[model samples]
Target: MKKRVVITGIGAVTPLGNTMETTWNNVVKGNSGIAPLTRIDSENFQVKVAGEVKNFNPADYIDSKEARRMARFTHFAIAASKMAMNDAGLKVGDNLDGERTGVWIGSGIGGLDEFEEQHKRFLAKGPKRVSPFTIPMFIPDMASGRVSIELGAKGMNNCSVTACASGANSIGDAFRVVQNGITDVMIAGGTEASITEMTIAGFTNMTALSTNPDPTKASRPFDKNRDGFVIAEGAGIMILEELEHARSRGARIYGEIVGYGATGDAYHITTPAPNGEGGQRAMKLALQDANITTQQVDYINAHGTSTYYNDLYETQAIKKVFGDHAYRLAVSSTKSMTGHMLGAAGAVEAIFAILAIKEGMIPPTINYSTADEELDLNYIPNSCKETSVEVAMSNSLGFGGHNATLVFRKFN
Candidate 1:
């Protein structure tokens, strides 16, 4: 029989807060993490605002000298992963076998800050001026590599880079690794620190970022006036352990991850497949993997990026999959508040899904003042809802047409 996997611990460093509880509490209150872009000066840019992780201190989690050697993305990953391992009550080389505990973290555009800084030095003072750690700091996979080294994880260390779906894909891949009995535990999720001048200008030029001057009103997902997504950065890590292993250690279970579905939209490099066909298939596939019908899904954490196509197409996809039952279930986009965390979006949102199940409260899609006619759903708009959710589904659709869905059920 396939091994069953359960989430025993969770961690996150988000725009809302540096720790998971602070972030979750703010989310439940319909608070907006989106604010004026302070990470970089927006004087020369059209995009005036973004969701930036405020007041974060890497030295709080990593040694000051050691943290300097890693990129910002790796810093976030390490902090979150350490928090997760602590939450799971497992220490370095303790309570778990290092050979069987792995790390899988993803980044869509890893270390853009590192790259920009190094390139500036290279131009100003030649290649020799560039730090020797340039490659280690700029690579996407470095998050996983450094995490494994720091945490003593020796099993399947990997990274996924499928745009916004990177986090979910990494978690899904890690799930399979444990389910297949290749590992007993996996530290898996995604991280991103790409909120830099080049990334912002690139996304702005493509009209993929919100140009709204008011940060509070910018990321209004499902609202009729949403222009584009406001990019953000963060990391979310989860400790996924086999049920038997968790029970043996008497670990606290958050929820059981029962299903994972991943698909690609070969139709476009930057847009979702027409009518969200890929997303629809991914959701259906996850339900099948979970052996549950559409009616059994109580909540759906949407990949609602607040863009025109994503909001409309995702609504269509949900309706197509659930049919009339779509309106009956609650669907909300935490990105409406968190902004789009890019690679970290899925992992953080997955934690939100599980929290919704555990706390019996669904986070709201805030800033939803005006709604689109065709994009109607419960949304739980502008206010949190206290409801018992037996099964929660989180969907992540990314650029390059990546679609991923994960199903988390309330543990008995």
Candidate 2:
């Protein structure tokens, strides 16, 4: 029998808050994190609002010298990892077997801020003006590498980069490592900090961001007014441990990871397949892996990025997979509040789903003024609800047609 995996600790740095408690509190309050762009000059841009993590001082987490060598994404990842490790009562350079504790983190794009600065320096001065840390700071895998090096985890160090699916894929992949006896404990999640001029311009040029100037109303997922997704930045990290290992050490278990499924649409790079075929397959696969039917799914944290295509197709996919049972499911898109975290979306939403099960409360999908007639379901609109969720699922669809689903069951 395969070993079971459980989430013992969690941490986050998002637009809603820099720490997990503050973020979760704001999320539960149905507060919007989206605001006017402060990270970059937005006076001349069509898309003026985004979800930016505020007041994050890099020197607070890493030394000045080390901080300069890492990208903003890596800095966020390491900072959150430290919180998660501390919450789990684990220590770097301490008693745990370094061979059994690993780190798996991911990012959609790494060090855009660093790359932009270095490129400017190189153009202004000469080639020697570019810092020697430029290459290491720019790579996507540096987040995982740096966290592992800092924490002294000698186990499987890896990164997942399936665009928006990066975070969930990384966490799911890390669970498999411990379930298969490759390790006993794993620190895993995803992070993103690509809020530079070029990054915003690229997404804006592609018409993928909502141009609505009102930050509070910009990211209305499932609402008819939703123009497009609002780009956001942050990191979400969770501690996954073998069930027996957690119990042996008296670790607090938040929830059990029951199943995971990842698939490729093979249809389009940016657009999802018609009617969410890839998303449906991912849900079905996750259910099969969990050895349960669609009727047992109590809630779903949807990949509702507020885009016209995603909200409609994802709703259709849920109905297709669950049929009438879909009506009984409480589906909410926390992106309504957190905005879309891009690569970090899945990890943050996974935490939202798990907390829903733990707290027995369904978070609200704010700003749901009008729902499409074709897409009808219990989306927990506008207000949070008190509900008993036994099993919850989180969905993430990424660019390049990658679709991933994860199921979390309340541990008995």
Which candidate leads in TM-score? 1
Candidates' TM-scores? 0.99, 0.98
Instruction: State the lDDT of candidate 1 residue by residue for 109-138, as single tens digits.
Output: 999899999999999999889999999998
Candidates in order have lDDT scores of 0.94, 0.91
Candidate 1's C-alpha runs over 4 A off are none
Poorest 10 consecutive residues by lDDT, candidate 2: 88-97
Question: Where in model 2 is the C-alpha error above 4 Å?
Answer: 92-95
Cα RMSD for predicted model 2:
1.0
RMSD to the true structure for each prediction, in A, is 0.7, 1.0
